[model samples]
Target: MTPISQLSPRLLWQFFDTLCSIPHPSGHEAALRQWIADWAVERGLDVMQDAVGNLIIRKAASAGMEKRKGVILQAHMDMVPQANADTDHNFTTDPIQPYIDGDWVRARGTTLGADNGIGLSACMAVLADDKVQHGPLEVLLTIDEESGMTGAFGLAPGLLQGDILLNTDSEQDGDVYMGCAGGVDANITLPYEAEPVPAGHQALRLTITGLRGGHSGINIHQGRASANKLLAELLMDISQHAELRLSELDGGTLRNAIAREASALLTLPADAMDTLSALLERRQQQYRCEFAGIDDFIRLELAPATMPARVMSTSLQQRLSDALLACPHGVMEMSRSMDGVVQSSTNLGVIGTRPEHIHVQCLIRSLNDEGRNRVAEMTAAVFRLAGARCNFDGAYPGWQPDPDSAVMQLLLDTHKELFDVLPEVKVIHAGLECGLFKAVYPGWDMVSFGPTIQGAHSPDERVHIEAVSRFWQLLVRVLKQIPER
Candidate 1:
């Protein structure tokens, strides 16, 4: 494995390597915050912390650049903690182990945190480097961005003095983002009755794994299968041909991640084992063919397990399965206004059967407020029909595009001059902190861009090495070209 210190743009990689060693998962950014504050204080820079743990580090302008517009470099400090089912790692205590894999840098068996970590590292590099020419700079590092926008939501008004904000949380390189989708979370729950297992029935655990689950918003259009939806379909199909009772059900990890694995404990007639095996094989083949290009390693496993004492009643089982099948899990509509842009989508992100009730959660995203509301209502209606109560929360607004802004032009011209090619300027479907920032700081101009990262929010997450260098160059040049206030 190649050491990250040897990677080009040494300072950026060095900071990122150190960041990976700290446990900074969403809602647990205290250690990282202290480290960042200490690093800034060691250099005699001004560091301020808000009530909600958002950090603001100030750097003075270099010689002859005091009159340039103040720019805010923004990124989140928390990361989504995810790992493979077999990897024995804990996000709260264990450090992320990253190594070079060809052209990318990936963690051993967990998320690499490069989504915003790389962005934050760029800001650190700029603050540490005296050779880079720039105006007065404020680096805004927020908390709990991956799980919720708590830090951004609680940011006080008038906390920042910058006129323009440059967000570095985007995933793709060479693409400047002017706008992003807004999102809301929908939670549904249904109560059930438990019954004793029937005579002559055997217990089995059905496991689904090997799917390449990814970020729900970014990969929703790629036709990757959702384990919750797929398992529901299988259970529904099996219930038609066999006397099966569901005892336990669980899948997925977060409200914003597509489920890669699911499991169900079931009691079925002993004679039906052969039939169930054949059905699973057939469905597995069908799914493999459907998701060929993106998810080729899909697998279904069945093993004998200790018999559960009780199982869901017939009426409740049927209703829960029906609700799961009816729930939407992919792109609902595309933007007619912007070519090739996703307008509305939903991810049935998590499902679990608890002692008192069965819970289902989803994340809906859209470019416009009306579209976001429409999808949330539609998803709620699906569960409501099955006698489940639904609630929507954690709603965040979308960032509107500004094509004529001076900062946008500066970034465009800088990229063209540096690379001799025009960069793509467009809006993305993923949620970004800029939307939340815009709500409080209405007059501030904003744009987002970052190095290329793949499989974020998943164990396969990796960052492209060369793209980080290119992104650093672009950022430094853009800092030098900030317009006079």
Candidate 2:
């Protein structure tokens, strides 16, 4: 069946359906990039690709609108690769199976790639439409935005020559995003040694599950229980109240997402098993009550295990547990200017103990370079206090909004002219390529807006089919209303 016939808002359904038939997961966007070029060439548009695989497709101004200003429409081509553990969808080569669920478009057991792919589709749809009125248009499709933003970061100077840029990457439809938080990935490591344990000690597995994990920046202040922190706290309590030897500890997957589940195998004295189980039950009840609103599914369970007797030394175990507890996670600071907005945050997303090293990964974000550095320093300080060696990489600046920007005024006017209602302008908590683009093209005015997308970076990701039409309508109005310089 044709995609347009399967969903509402014909243009959006057609665009989204075409996007799903391609595999554009982060770091695997070569095919999508080439496809975009082919699509542009088919329309007789001038398309070019940067060395780092950023596509810029140019279309002339609509008839009678040639005197209007030129505008750049930007969207990333990559999507976060995520799937339920039970899902067999392979992101490396398989196309996203976009299906309609009422007004939303979702994939089958995999991420829908609507986070930015929808934005890309919207831009492409506008480019192909011969009837849509607009100025000189340039569509920039960047690669590798989900994982590292390598395409934006690696953009060669002087490739784009637009004075105003519209980033179609925001998740909300009514909100106009002008600023985003800067971020850095901090990697921490600790030395550890595992040895055979006494024969009398028993093995037990401790598991924490059902936590409501989300985007660290968007949901950090919600107090959702982190699986890594929960497991670490329980182990610390056991390490203090009872004699416990750590055999293996592992939790979390991505370094950016809050851990939802964690498991630890350890050796404990047979005499202490009953007391430990009782303590765990009490703690679980206490935490359930604490996170009742944020994570109603929080669970902690203990069961016997048949693991080998090898274990980490008590000293090493103490150090690791202390570090995990001390390292700060979640919202660290609130925005001074924006009410209820997070200014800076850190996510203790992953923890694992290997044969020779205990590794921890944290994602830090802030609106300013100084604030980002502050959070990074705070995290490193905690690691240092716990005697762990810390390292950091992949640092990028934040996009600062200009309240009096000429393009912002044009957008405000255009939005009002089309809908008779003003769009809510604000900053977003997540990281975007706007920050990197600003660095490359200083003095360029930029704003981001998109259709409603939910559950990004997760399997439940979906996009509102109707919002795409609204988004397209607003974007076309903005382009047509651009004033001459």
RMSD (CA, Å), each prediction: 1.1, 2.3
Residues 1-485, model 1: lDDT tens digits: 23997798999999999999998999899999999999999999999999999999999999999999999999999999989999999999999999999999999989999989999999999999999899999999999998889999999999999999999999888899999999999999999689999999999999999988899988888888899899999999999999989999899989888899999999999999999999999999999999898989989999999999899999889989998998987999999989989999999889888889999999999998999999999998989898999999999999999877788888999999999988899898899989999999998999999999999888989999999999999999999989788
Candidate 2 Cα errors over 4 Å, as ranges: 1-5, 270-273, 303-309
| Candidate 2 residue lDDT tens string, 355-396 | 788889999999998889998998999889878899989888
Weakest 10 consecutive residues of candidate 2 by summed lDDT: 1-10
TM-score of 1: 0.99
TM-scores of all models?
0.99, 0.93
Q: Which window of ten consecutive residues has the lowest lDDT sum in model 1?
A: 1-10
lDDT of 1 at 164: 94
Off by over 4 Å in 1: none
> Residue 68 CA error for candidate 2 (Å)?
2.4
Clashing pairs in 1: none
Candidate models: Cα lDDT each: 0.93, 0.83
